[model samples]
Target chain A: MLYNAFLQAIREIKRNMMRSALTAIGIVIGIASVIAMVNIGKGASASITQSVSKLGSNNLLILPGQTRGGPGGASSFAKPFKPNDLNVLKSSINTLEAVSPVENTSMTVVYKDQNYRTNIKGVNNDYFTVQSLEVDLGRKFEKSELRTGQSACIVGKTVVKKLFAPDENVLGQKIRLKNFSCVIVGTLVEKGANTFGGDQDDLILVPTKMFQRRISGNNNIHMITVSVKKNIPLEEAKLQIDQVLRESRHIKANDEADFTILSFTTLLDTISQITAILTVMLGAVAAISLIVGGVGIMNIMLVSVTERTREIGIRMAVGAMAADILIQFLIESVVLSALGGIVGVLLGLAITYGVAIGLDIQLILDPSITVLSLLFSMLIGVIFGISPARKAANMNPIDALRYE
Target chain B: MIKLAGITKTYGSGEVATQVLKGIDLQIEKGEFVAIMGPSGSGKSTLLNILGALDVPTEGDYSFMDTNIRGLSKDQLALFRRNILGFVFQGFNLLKKTSALANVEMPLIYQGVSAKERHKRALEVLSSVGLQERVDYDPGQLSGGEQQRVAIARAIVTRPKVLIADEPTGNLDTKRSHEIMQLITGFNREGITVVMVTHEEEMAEYASRIIRLRDGMIEKDGHHAV
Candidate 1:
């Protein structure tokens, strides 16, 4: 019975092909936007994870202020950490692999005829080990150079490219900073763009003592990077670091520690949560359009019922049950929306493809979502189709036949 | 085999009440062609609707082959019409934009007939109505006579016990009306009971029994040998 209804529905749709296609455009756009929004959101979030993990997932960052709002920002007026906190964390945390104090400042470096702006990092060799970085063409800082505050520096690949010719031999070459000059003792290897698309190889590294004496003119360390051992869980290391930092900073028991401790995994979780919420929000907006599309279908279906009253009357006179009439109209709407779903899927994939390339993100097509959208479109038809179908089915045959 | 006892159909209530079929008691035997003739408001169409099980009489026991139609549910009444009766309208009410064969095949679709068998039966019935070559033609593409022929073919395709036609030739000219009457007569000869309502005297003569209605009651009923 349903199969025959489907056949009748197809014929009816074909009879009014133009009107049917036009009526389905609403569902097409609704499903299409839904698919595009979800897929693009997923691709962007996954891209973030990929880029962030590239910076080494086992590392934890300790900033000397509370994360005032969320994971990213810090309180600007908080006191800076001294080297004492770093020693305490190293002694207290058994899961520790390596730790390095990090101080940074951005300034322009000048080489004869060229000048380029870049960030300079103040750290020891432990910073490279924690970040899994290799200075492919350079040597590490000497113990005396690190301890005595000598004007020695290691330049990143970008700084080298901006300051000197491709093969001009950067070692022992002096580059001028804002108010002083430093001799480059090594040049670091190239690492590409980070997750947020900022260049990873765009900074110079100087010994911590020289950076404090010649640049910062203070003993304050702004941040610290800690790497956990391969088999260590981050929570255990974080607990010890928190304890040590709290004690060294003289925070009383039961008081909120005025420092923020962040791990790469925690940051990834926060970012994932943010992306999921964004996806749901975008999906909700798309769903509203779908509902509007459903309303459009209902409107058209009600009009169709009115227009086909005589037809319904004829079928009723020729041995059709009211259920038969109901099924016929219901099938018509389902067929219409399912067709829209198919077209929407193709259009959505086209949009996703175009935007993925344009935004330089990953292209991820979730097969289940495709199938779900198709089913959802059909469901929209049924949900919105019942009223009109009932109207057609409950028609008085005599009055219907007499309808002009 | 149709019977109607004390059938009363009234529209509205209170001061606006108008009874269409009042105290109608009629019986139609199998293989009989009965014509109902009356002026407008004589309740002829309402009586036909009751006979066809399209509407329930406000007060009546409508028994078709010993089954009470008034006792049937809405779907059951639809099934009663589907199984035992067929209808041909004055308008030729062949489903618009549908081919003659498909229109003829419609009743069998509800009867649960298989597609191939229904196709075969529709073609055979259309050919019997002298529309074999025009089976693929839609209602708009056919002349008045041809469209009525398709409607008749649809009415008889299910092999219904009674074929109910309400002014089957009202839209046709004299010659086309005669042609459609002859077609209905042919189906009656083949043992299908036909109940028709018409206003024309000439059309009434074609039926073996002619019943005339005045107001809501039968004024005269005459039966003759075919």
Candidate 2:
């Protein structure tokens, strides 16, 4: 009986091809948006985790800030740490393997007439080892160059691509940094992009001494990054560093510290929480469309029942039970919604793939969500289709037969 | 066999009440070809609806082969109609846009007949109605007479115990009306009890008995030599 009803319902839908397809569009858009939002959110979360791991989980960033690492706190105009603080933390903290005092600037580099604006980050050679970087060609800065404050720098992969030819011998080449020129000591390996889609290889690295003496001409340190010993607990390292920095900076024991330290774990957690919230918010908005789609189905179904009144009357007179009519309408609505859901899933995946490639994030399609979306669409049909099906089923055959 | 005792059907209630059929008591034996003739508002349609189990009488005892039909639930009435009665209408109520064979196969689908069996029986019935070549033709694609023939084929496909037709030739021309009446007569000759409603005397002459209803009452009922 159900099989026969299903066949009849399909035929009925096919008879009014344009109306049925138009009705299904609401469901298609709803499901498609849900799939696209959820999958993209998941892909971004995965990409964040991947880049965080690549940047080294044992890494800790010490920013000159107070309270949380939010925009206001991180970019606070507090007293920047001096080179003395970096020296103190290096000597006192036994758990720290290496610490780099970062003095950063965005400066224009010139080589003959070819010029490009890029970030100029100044640090010691220890920063490269702590960050697990390698010189792809030539060599890193020599010990004498660090002590003498020489103008020798290593150009990262992006700077090399922007400033020189691919096969050009870049070693010993001098590139002007605004006033003074710096000789390229090496070419850094490609680091690609980070989680926030920042170009990691798009900067030139110089010694902190040369940067302080020639570029900024000051002793203030903008940021400091340290790598903890492998066997040491990260929390203990943070507390030790926190205590030393407080004592070195002469803040009282009861006073709030004037610095903030961020670990990779905390960054990952914050990003993960944000992505999860975004997914739920977007999915919820998409779900509202699903309800609207269901209402559309109901509207069309009510019209269909009225339009086929004589058909229902004829079927009843030919021995169809009321339950038969109900099942037939119910099946028709479900089939319509399911077809829409299928198309939505495909469209969503296509959009996701395109966005993933464009934005350079991972593409992750959750299987359970795909199945859930399909079931939810079918449920929408059942919920919205009940009244109309009952209307058709409970119709008086005499009146229906006589309906013009 | 069919029997109705004191059947009355009233529409609405109180001061607005309109009585369509008033105390109709009738009987028909096995293999009887009966024709009911009446003017408009004579309640012939109402009587046919009660006989077909499409509507319950307002106050009456209706029994088919000694089984009471008045107390049967709506579903039970449907089963009774499915198992024992067939209906053809003046409008030629074959589903629009459906092929002739598919229309004929509809009643058997409700009967739970297998696909192969339904096809075979639908084919045989369509051929019996001389519509074998038009089995794939839709109602919109067929003439008035051809559509009526398809309807007749559908009604008889289930081998119903009684064929109930309401104004079977009301929408057809004289030539098509005779053609349809001849088909009904042939089905009746096959020993299936035929109960038909018609306003045309020529169609009435095709039956072995003629019952005339006037103002919801039977004015005359007896065997008429055809």
Give the C-alpha lDDT of model 2: 0.91
Q: List the lowest-lDDT window of 10 residues for candidate 1 chain A.
A: A68-77
For model 2, residues A240-274, the per-residue Cα lDDT tens digits are: 99999999999998998888888888888887988
The parts of candidate 2 lying over 4 Å away from their true place are A69-72, A82-85, A92-94, A107-118, A136-204, A209-218, A230-233, A246-255
Residue-level lDDT tens digits of model 1 in A59-165: 88998788854665976578998978878887877788889888989999998999999998999888988977887776888899988989888888888888888
Task: Compute DockQ for each candidate against the true complex.
Answer: 0.82, 0.75
What local distance difference test score does each model get?
Answer: 0.89, 0.91
TM-score for each of the candidates: 0.96, 0.90
Per-residue lDDT of model 1, residues B77-153, tens digit only: 88888888888889888888888888899889899999999999999999999999999998899999999999898
lDDT of model number 1: 0.89
In angstroms, the error of model 1 at A200 is: 1.8
* TM-score of chain A, all candidates: 0.96, 0.87
